[model samples]
Target chain A: MRRVLVIEDDPKDMAITRNAVLRAGLFPDCVATGEEALSYLLRNDCAYILVEPCVKGLNLPLILSLANKRDRKAAIVVITKDSSLTSERKLREMGILYYMVKPADDMELSMVLQNGKAD
Target chain B: MEKPISILLVDDEADFRAIISDHLEEKGYQVFSVGSGQEAISAAQEQDFDVALLDVKMPGMDGVNLLQMLKEIDPSVEVIMLTGHATIETAVQSIKLGALDYLSKPVRLSELEVTIARALEVRHLRRQAFQLRERLRQKEAFPEIIGKSRKILAIQQQIEQVAQTDATVLIEGESGSGKELVAKAIHRRSKRGDGPFIVLNCGALQESLLENELFGHEKGAFTGASTEKRGLVEVADGGTLFVDEVAEMSLACQTRFLRILEAGDYRRLGSTKDLKVDLRIIAATNKKLAERAKQGQFREDLFYRLNVFRIVVPPLRERKEDIPILIGHFLANSEVGPKPPPPVSPEALESLMDYSWPGNVREVANVVERTLIVSQGLPIRPQHLNLTSREVPLVTCGEKDLLPLEQVERDHIQKVLAAVSGNKRRAARILGISLRNLYRKLEHYGLANSEPLKTAL
Candidate 1:
């Protein structure tokens, strides 16, 4: 089974994302803060990393760089409330697999993670 | 026939209450003055009041408490609090308890009247917004045609204009291009909107079956005719009867339909009595109906009668700009997926725009629904769309080279004129321009004779 690292500060959103990942036949390693997410990435190997950009203590670009160094194959998916195209381009340039705005359908996230990449 | 605005005045002082009540009555208001909060509650229980005035300092059940109680009784009642010993705390408390407004004691009669007027205006606006929301919610009650293109705007205008009369309407469009939606719009807007709107597809049944289904059969009229049946015409008596694919109606059936169009009367098969019904007929066809009528395939007289009001629904490809809006609407309203269907990716939207939807708006709905299921819990991408690589033709101009702007306009006007058989008025309507403007263009292009017709104004 694949392992998914779920990083969400919101308790409700984290629970929903964990459930979706578990339902997609993947084990979820959950964290509430960006510092915890960075430490978890350093100590563990996971197939996918799900994140929210607005989490406390989040350095999204640095987190993306660390994830890339730790596991070059990890597919980083950013779910954020900022729907600006500038942010999307910056995230995409950092090699994130997908950028979903807030109110992102949980079911789609499960499918995207299950399939590895949306392409 | 308008009812007077009713106001309930509650003030402990008898002399003050009487003076205010008399002044309100002189201004043509039905004023009900009560000496105590209990009496005001009793009066409210007996009948409804549009507005209520409560004194903040009262003997029992003060104004703030009474405001809460009155709101509980009828949330629609507008309550204004009056205080002789005015304080910010009591004013804030009164408003927090749902008081519409608060005023200090010794308020001028004119000032009080202005407050009442403002309260009534607010209530009126709130009711209007609620009614508008309710009407929008009823979108599910009828087929909603959604598009913002000039072609669609013109069609909507035509529906509104034709809905005011009982004229027979002919809607011409390609297959799957929302002709039924236009018919329903006309019916829903007409005076007969409250009445039943029935539909019958002319192309669905064979000639004999179609006539039997339309006119219905009397008992013993045929071998399987065990009982008399009411036709769609009778069911739609007070409203509208929409006939779809009417060009496919057989010649024999056309003759029978012509009778109803000419005189609102039709007899059941094997029944001698003529049955009359009052109904408006709106017919739709995907075929070139005027040409078909001239070719002796359809009844020319029936064609002329049904063409009293003509509405042309443009094909989806012409309104491609509305594709994103339509897709969003379909995805949001779709029941296929769980609540909140996944969004479409930008690449997927571009692919959708590239394809020529030969089946028109209906095809877009089907594609969206199918993609929702296949994509599951993920944003829809081009792979989920599964469309073949077929790009829509940009233009169908005869020459590969681009024509000048004036020439393109002239050519389009000439083609539309020929399609409508040189009816300038109908051409102008289809072109979405004023009749005078169309005439000027025609003269500028030298398409029409210099000698204008008498009705050319």
Candidate 2:
């Protein structure tokens, strides 16, 4: 599998997501800010792009839009601290595969990665 | 890079207009305030505005009447109706008249801003969608293949043989040799020519994202999915999906792609429902697939499935005979309006022909465009040519290599296109080329501005 790209500003959240990927037997390349994520995506392919809702010096919407633009096929899973209806709707329109609230368990994350679709 | 969005405010109430205009201008909008519907109509006729705020009950002309006139002038300008009386009938009527949103009077500034923002967004999307549809419609006419060399003739013959069949074809070519153009030609000549011809760059996105694009997700399918979205497979139901750079797909994505090819059955990212599609897939790659398959870099089964029918797009170096003809085609096909391209000196032509086109026809196109820009309206001189430093032109020293026959009839059409910002109809009229011909060249050179990257997917 192509490695996942984790875009989380919060070190704790980034650690949790990175650990979850490792436990699932997948390697991931983590970026701390949206700028790093954008540069990374331009040159590297991401199996799944896990993005944070907000990051320092980076507009969340523009990042997601650029991500969506650069890679239309990648499943974009948003890791958001605030999943208000408005933000959810906005990010959804940005064409993300899903948005999970912060502090999600490793098991749930792994399950979503594998066999989340009932069909 | 983004120009400020301009707004036209029309309200009969002077005090209301003054207060709202002041606040909006403070927010950094280029606000143009007028007191009545008549003034709004005249102002709209005078200048292009992004959005128009019209009061429902205006003195001289009602908002509804003015709305029709404004739309007649420019249907793209977004209009928001403001009313003091809360009548459901008027609201419905305003909407029917193509009002973006209806706002009650005594409108809070914050709410007004939100409405205005939404209106602007709608305008932007509508413009994007319109441009997309126009390009697709224009893309229907395929360009004349500009090569008469044996390799190109063979490829053209192969295209003729396979165009009518609904088969999976893998086009192999070097980058920039017009692999995508060949795909479009195949689609144009196919039975599905009338249907949507969608394209995806397989190498551009990762495996997981590619899956979402091919198979859509449902509402609440993931955290951010608020509504059910359709995928490219569904969109390409009756047409063709041209997946470019198929060799760039990861092994996992290749497996998924093969499954789709095998069964035409797939599920969206999160949905439980299985979607079956009926369409032909045309995939292209510059890589030698068989070699890659042997090296275990590509799956043998997927390669076999994709290689059922193959078209090798010969590189430009193999067809040096076509260079002059190709130059003529490019010169005639310049995006420059009515003005014909300046004549090319024989020496300049020799330099262009001698330079190895590492970037293939795409590079040739760029050189032609850049040379045209540098040459201005003068005959193309040897110095006007911009080639890589490595390819020293075989220039005849000391002689001003001039063409005995000055084919300077070309008026250098760039100015008309610049005047119109590449609007094809006006360009066609000035250049005397058919609208379809202009579109074909523009599409070939990738000059059309608002190409629908997400749409027709």
Query: What digit string (tens of lDDT, one per residue) describes model 1 on residues A1-119?
Result: 76888888888888878888988889999988888888888888787888888888888877776676442357787877776645654564355655566655565566667654421
- Give me the candidate number with maximum TM-score: 1
* Local accuracy of candidate 2 as per-residue lDDT tens digits, A6-77: 888788988989887777666789998867877887787656777786766656666654554432345677
Best by DockQ: 2
Could you give candidate 2's per-residue lDDT for residues B362-427 as a string of tens digits? 878778877887888799878988687548656675546554332222223344566566566997
Off by over 4 Å in 1: A1-119, B1-143, B392-457
Kindly report the fnat of each predicted structure, to 2 decimals. Answer: 0.00, 0.00
**Candidate 2 segments whose C-alpha is farther than 4 A from its true place:** A1-119, B1-144, B392-457
* lDDT for B373 (candidate 1): 83
Q: Identify the candidate with maximal lDDT.
A: 1
